[model samples]
Target: MKPDIHPVSRPVVFRDRAAGVAFLTRSTAHSTRTIEWEDGAVHPLVDVEISSASHPFHTGTSRVLDTAGRVERFERRYGRTAPNRR
Candidate 1:
């Protein structure tokens, strides 16, 4: 209810570098950079590394870590150390 204390909610552009996609939506976040949208409206620009466009699961390109390889390397160094052995 206070002026200047409330978050500014306005239209913003989120840019995804990897997927080369730009999205326009409303947000309360602030930014110093600005750009013109496709509709010829100037708005704050937010650069993001990943989004729905480039996200692995979203794009059906998810990658799994090789935990088996890591465990083998670790055991080679520690001689396959056992935990809580009686």
Candidate 2:
């Protein structure tokens, strides 16, 4: 463990603009903006478009696509049948 090799991990607030969610975590990332946290402490704030709260996958709003089913349906309609493995 060298003194100069380690990066600082301080509390940073990542705010999701659309979802209105704020995350408090330690990161090396720094910003000029600051905000008062829920605990009455000020921390560096980073504005983000999407976060775990707003992201489709994390929020369970992601669209599930059936690739195999869609391909079969397309082949049947377009009349381009693939070779049967059987």
Candidate 3:
């Protein structure tokens, strides 16, 4: 272990804007914003676009891409440019 060479791990709040959820955890990440936590203490606030609260996998709202429809449309427009094997 080295002195004065490691990041400080402290209690910080991560806010998921989309999910409207905030959680406190120990992290080495830093932030310029401040937020008043539920315990009435001010902590460093980090804004995140997505987290476990709003993620597709965690929320079970995953989106399926329309690749088959896209392939059909491409073939209709380009007349099957790929060669077929016997």
Candidate 4:
């Protein structure tokens, strides 16, 4: 409830280059680039490498890591050791 302390929030356009999608929202982040939104208004354009549109988890394209294979590889590289008995 403080006054003159919060950063200004303005309409900004976040463009996801990989997914080729643009979203209009309010944010404190600033950018030198500008984009004309569908509403015929210019908004600061921020380019992001990845967003929900293209992220593996969000897109359901995430790969399950091969932990078993990794363990085997590590053991091969450094011979497996016997359990340390206290």
lDDT by residue (tens digit), candidate 3, 28-73: 8889999999999999999999999999999999989999999999
lDDT of 2 by residue, 4-82 (tens): 8888899999999989989999999989999999999999999999998999999999998999999999888998956
Quantify all predictions' global Cα lDDT against the true fold.
0.92, 0.93, 0.95, 0.97
Sorted by lDDT (best first), the order is 4, 3, 2, 1
After superposition, which runs of candidate 2 have C-alpha atoms over 4 Å from their true positions? 81-86
Clashing pairs counted in every model? 0, 0, 0, 0
Name the runs in model 1 displaced over 4 angstroms: 1-5, 65-83
Q: In candidate 4, how many clashes are counted?
A: 0
TM-score of each: 0.70, 0.81, 0.75, 0.81
Error of 1 at 12 (Å): 0.4
Better of 1 and 2 by TM-score: 2
Q: After superposition, how far is residue 79 of candidate 3 from its true place, in Å?
A: 2.7
